[model samples]
Target: MQNDIIKCGLTEQTDSQFVDSIEKEAYVWYEKNWKHDDYEHSHHRSQLTFVEEGYQYFHIDQKIYLVPQNHIIWIPSGKLHKITSEAQTVNLMVFLFKSVFKDDFYRDLQVFAVSAVLKEMLLYASKWSQSVTEDEEQDIFFKAILKSLPNFCKESNFLEIPVPKDERLIPVCHYINVNFKYNLDIDSLAEKGKMSVRSLQRIFKNETGITLQKYHQLIRILKSIELIDTKQYTLSQIAYLVGYQSLSAFTSSYFSIMKSKPKINKK
Candidate 1:
């Protein structure tokens, strides 16, 4: 019993150090899997993050990104971001880049669909102990993969929802999130939050950079992604669960955001 307690203490210490290193932007953090909760930090080097098993959410550039499995998220250097997940085990792979590549694509955040080719390339590159290698052959292979990212990752994902900056709209946003599995109209949402329709529409758009209707759609679709990842329900059931009366509406919303068909992202 004492040994178990000591081991847990050590784990907590390691996790704390991990956050410190990341905050200083001095670490090249990559592993086959990690058991962690939502924490905010940044890195000196750019990152290519993919989830092989479970889904995770990222709060970046004041937007909430739902990164379901099989999707790749590109984070540029010095971007303050926080990651969160509810899955018991999140099997993720992160590739850190010490040197910035010469591409405008590398300058901003992009979460895109991971092609089979890109997935194999990322997995193969994961063998390296260091992201910046000195071995001539390995360096050449790595450069090749880096150069090919733009070609392989052309489809831009739309899973991003802007985070609210207005304090007044917090409860309103919460109401939409909590009741996303129902037909939530703007008038009712405004009434629930004790705001006029005009004020609610204007403030929501200003703070979140999206209208209340769009925000509602995003929340519902985001919930559906989580439900789909569980693999416990059928697509029809998932659509209904997320408050879509018809599977067609759910599919349309999902494809609009994810740029792909809904399926479990497993090889």
Candidate 2:
């Protein structure tokens, strides 16, 4: 139930030092069992998160994203976010200041599929705490990994949910993002979107592939994850922030969706 904060600096001879030796390099791989008391606030850093085991909900801006094994979450520098994991899971994380990578490489925040090569590279980087002599090799390998990242523009249509092109749905989705804390339902959302309930439901389902209620749940859960990952607020505080009437209700819904209780750790 303790909140642990480990800052990796270049001058420090800790596990993060191997990463620190490389200009703009920051990487850490560790296992931890996090409890309800562990909450974190968002801070500025370009980060890449890869989960080798378990499931997690990641919240960024007002969107909730489901992350599973071999799936990576990339946080742009300065973007606010949090994470909530299903259990004690093995996760590999790389943090960079963005200035380290070439300018064009760091343009957007995205989650990409991890290839076998990238996975092995992560494994090597995780072992950095064990060897300082591998600093040169690690630096070269890290750059190669970054260079191998697929450009978004080239494969923009891959696995990403495109924002609706419809103008009517735009304002509705925007309102939902801004007011997720409110009890928003089809009727209320329809009224706000200036459409009939039936039409709203149809359009929303077509655009997002889920019902309105389910979508809202997804959004709420994602937000909760962000709050947890960043250590920004307590579980009770996050529960209320996402519009749950009770902590138990929030916990139940979270477990139902993620298939496990909220816990964070290295697998």
Candidate 3:
């Protein structure tokens, strides 16, 4: 694979007595600069990608998911997806063999909130030596991680920008992605897509699984999230930049989408 990050693989072998067992393996990547995989690919093993710093954008299931710092994206085995990293991103991806998780429990791609404990555990797991044996102390730690996986896993309520397969909708999706800061309405978007307002609404709902207004709202909130920690911009400025006319309305909408208040650390 063509990547800008440095990657390493760690493997654990089992003794002959455990012939039925699958070997435990992990591939760790530390990304520094921005990069992207424009093509889709799938892995035989399940993947847990953790964002330690910075953020990443993932294209999966015809939707765009913005994975910010401290979040985890759980990709099931054989799930086709692509990823683009933001500048100075440092992330780790743990590739687990099929036997690591039951099929029913991890059959789809998901985003999860990472607790402090889970973060530490993932860090520790990434450091396991290649000579790791089945009975080592790390083995017990790995087992504990496996036991805790189900409890830690959850579906994130983050903003998802669904991309429709229809070619006509491509221009509309692109417009929302690039010009989210501008005033946009269904009628204007319909005109841009060269379709009637009702046809645009129907096609957008059918293709993206979200109404046009909600999708626009999601993009605005997502943009605010990206700008929250910039320090150069005040909360009010950030809100206005993302198309919200009122700070109160922006805060309310932000809290609704992010499930938390926006933290500002201006200098």
For residues 1-267, could you state the per-residue lDDT of candidate 2 as single tens digits? 222333433232222221244433544543334231122334445666666654465655444566655667766665655566654443545445434465655767666656777777777677664233436676676666666665422332122323565678878877777778888767777887799999999987887676777766766776676566655577788899999998898999788665556543321
lDDT of each: 0.71, 0.60, 0.68
Candidate 3 clashing pairs, residues 3+ apart or interchain: none
| Residue ranges of candidate 1 with Cα displaced over 4 Å | 1-30, 129-133, 155-157, 264-267
lDDT of 3 by residue, 69-132 (tens): 6788877766777776543434444435444655466676777668889988877766653332
lDDT by residue for model 1 over 160-249, one digit each (tens)?
878787777888888889999877677877886688989889888878777888888889888887887777788999999999988888
Model 3, residue 10: displacement in angstroms? 9.4
User: How does each model score on TM-score?
Assistant: 0.82, 0.52, 0.80
TM-score of 3: 0.80
Candidate 1: 10-residue stretch with minimal lDDT: 1-10
What ranges in model 2 sit over 4 Å off? 1-24, 32-40, 88-90, 103-105, 130-134, 151-195, 198-267
Clashes of each: 0, 13, 0
